[model samples]
Target: MNRPTTLREAIEAADSILIGAGAGLSAADGDHHSGPVFDARFADFRDQRGITDAYSGGFYPFPTSEERWAFWSRMISLLRYEAGPGQVYADLLGLVSERDYFIITTNVDHRFQTSGFDKEHLFYTQGDYGLLQCSVPCHDATYDNEKWVRQAVASQEGMRIPSELIPQCPRCGEEMTTNLRVDARFVQDAGWAAAAGRYEDFLERTCVDRVLYLELGVGMNTPSIIKFPFWRRVYDNPEATYACVALDASAPAEIADRSLLIRGDIAEALASARG
Candidate 1:
């Protein structure tokens, strides 16, 4: 059978579906880390600091904390708060909504939840954009950051936010940081632990069944977490079908016969599969 036909049949026959998503999925939704959108949203930062992309801008050493918060607040607002879930995610939901499905994603944008995926069936291994934690990490806890981010985006002027608006850790009065997993200090609170447990339970219950391992836009940045594991499971379970839709997806020679790798835009590939 042809690849797309094979993939459709696999999905139709599987007992459950497990989705692994990466940064490319978000890129397909127009939240690319670089290019015209980056330039347009952060032209001032690019001209002043020579920081070209959102990823690099996070590390730029602004002279003051106020200036740093100014940069981050706007970035967070644009990427997370203001940018609602896009069509790609909605199309993905349409494809899997009828099936027993679980999602584990490295994307921190909260797109899965925003797109109406059940929270109990979703696990975000990385932290989220809508949260803040103590920089020194006095404790394993996270605070909702929407109000502060909105304030910063509105009150910032001339590359600096109001000094008084800078977030402080309530426990120790230290500076606050985004809940992104930049280092070992990232907080994984009770909610994070619960989600991780749920993902583990889902895998345990479904891995031995006729599962469809659907990976989307996964790259090698953190292969151990999703990519490598998916390949290993498919190799171990003959009944499991491995399928990937990405701009740079490939199956290893060992699993080539049992895998379907579609190299194309993620949104288009999903739409075709849903059809």
Candidate 2:
């Protein structure tokens, strides 16, 4: 059978589904890190700093914490708070809603939860845009950053937010940074720990069953986290089937027969599978 037909059959026959998503998935949903969208949203930064993309802008070293927060707050608001969950996320949810499903994604946009996926069954391996932690990470905790981010986006002037608006860590009174997993200092708070445990538990319970490992838009940036592991799981579990729908989808030669690799738009592939 063709890859798409095989994928549809696997989904229909599976007892459970595990979805692994990455940056490409978000990009497919119009949440691109670099492109016209980034240029339009951050024209000022682009003009001033020659920062071409949201991802690069996030790592750009500003002269002051206030300036950094100004840029980050606006970026977060555009990508997270202001933007609605895209249809691709909703479609993915529809495909697995009736099944025992769990999502493990490297995306930090919080789109899965926003698109109505059960929070209990979703694990965001990367940190979220809505969280902030101490730069020094004096404590294993994260703070909700919506209110401050909104305030910065609203009040900043000339590419800088007021110093008073800069977020401070409650524990150590140090400047705060986004809770992204950029380094070892990334805070995995109680909530993160719980979600991690849930993901592991879900895997243990379903890995041996007739599970469909559906990988979407995952790339080699962090293959070990989701891609490589899913490949390994499908290799180990005779009943597990591996399927990937991506712009560039190809399986290893060893698991060629057991895998479905659909190279195309993920949203289109998913919609076709659902039919």
User: How well is each residue in 114-151 modelled by candidate 2, as lDDT tens digits?
Assistant: 89999999889889999999999898989899989898
**Which pairs of residues clash in candidate 2, taking residues 3 or more apart in a chain or in different chains?**
none
Please, what is the TM-score per model?
0.95, 0.96
| Tens-digit lDDT track of model 1 for 134-192 | 99999999999998999998999989999999999999999999898878998999999
lDDT of 1 at 83: 81
C-alpha lDDT of residue 2 in model 1: 36
- Off by more than 4 A, model 1: 1-5
Of candidate 1, the 10-residue stretch with the lowest lDDT total is 1-10
lDDT of each: 0.88, 0.87
User: Best candidate, TM-score-wise?
Assistant: 2
C-alpha RMSD between model 1 and the true structure: 1.8
